[model samples]
Target: MSNTKDIPFSPPWQISDLGKPDEPKVTELAAGPAVARFAKMPIVIAEDDLVSRTLMNSLMEKWGFKAVVTKDGHEAMAALRAEQGPALTILDWMMPEMDGLQVCRRIRESGKMVYVIMLTSLGAKENIVEGLHAGADDYLIKPFDKNELLARIQVGLRILELHAALSARVKELEKAVGQIDDLKLRIPL
Candidate 1:
């Protein structure tokens, strides 16, 4: 398979169209009050341990995200494919049916703009490298700091915003190029 991209833009239907923005819901936070609301990104957290799952799910909500708690990789994949499934995903390394590494690889192969974050107990350098090579956008040790997790999530959100911007630009460029081609064809040359 060639690495070259003729038109690497996302499918028209899949493009993140920011048109007709959703009505903003005003919510008060402990830190402050009143601000414009943006679309809450769907965060898929695949964790088998009940305690951990509940903790992470609540944390994600506290950090302003819609969390889909899945007990296995299959469930995680299903959530990722859903219409409401946004690009950010958090996968626990150990899960039944399939492991996080496998899920990450599959997500990468599918090329759906999904960001896979592997949260595992393994802290070895080799393990970290392996997870990243297997398509994990980020990897966190099991006993992660809540603040750190939120920081990482913010970084991912910024990257996703950039992706949507680029995708929109691609569509605009395609239209402009098409118009130029049509004009060229109209002229006698």
Candidate 2:
């Protein structure tokens, strides 16, 4: 195999396209309130292929995300395990020192409420099922359309946000129940 760094990458879309008058710019679309809510949000990208990793990093950064790029599953896992780690991650199926599936399983076993997206060239039915079974929240094939990838990422962010909101609500309900129990204890029978 050739050195990943030596591999050339030509993205499906060009940065110049963003400036074209006939089409809407990514920045323009990302200026929405929803985008602002996720702006600069940290996200993990684990891809062994240099081209894919570079492309994902660029796209995530363009979309107002702070991408934490990793070359292998081990590094990805380390990033995910860090203090204040990102809640969203994109992982390629094949990688060195542990595949995406292993990382997914580890994440699940660790009981982290993370949103995982499997980005790989494996588009077969079984591969998709396997990835899902391994705890990937979403699966996207390679040579992916930037717009579609962005949409999927947005969905993951929304899901994470909802999870956070639900957790907070659960805590509030528990606190209220505890207070109610205390009140009941004080009341005369």
List model 1 lDDT by residue over 81-130, tens digit each: 88343378888888887999999998998878877788999899999999
TM-score of each: 0.79, 0.82
Write model 2 residue lDDT over 17-90, tens digit each, in one string: 33433333347354344444665556889999988888888887777667889999999988888725237899
Name every residue pair that clashes in candidate 2: none
Model 2 lDDT at residue 184: 93
The clash numbers for all candidates, in the given order, read: 0, 0
Kindly give the stretch of ten consecutive residues in candidate 1 with the minimal lDDT sum: 30-39
Evaluate all candidate structures by whole-model CA lDDT and list the values in order: 0.73, 0.78
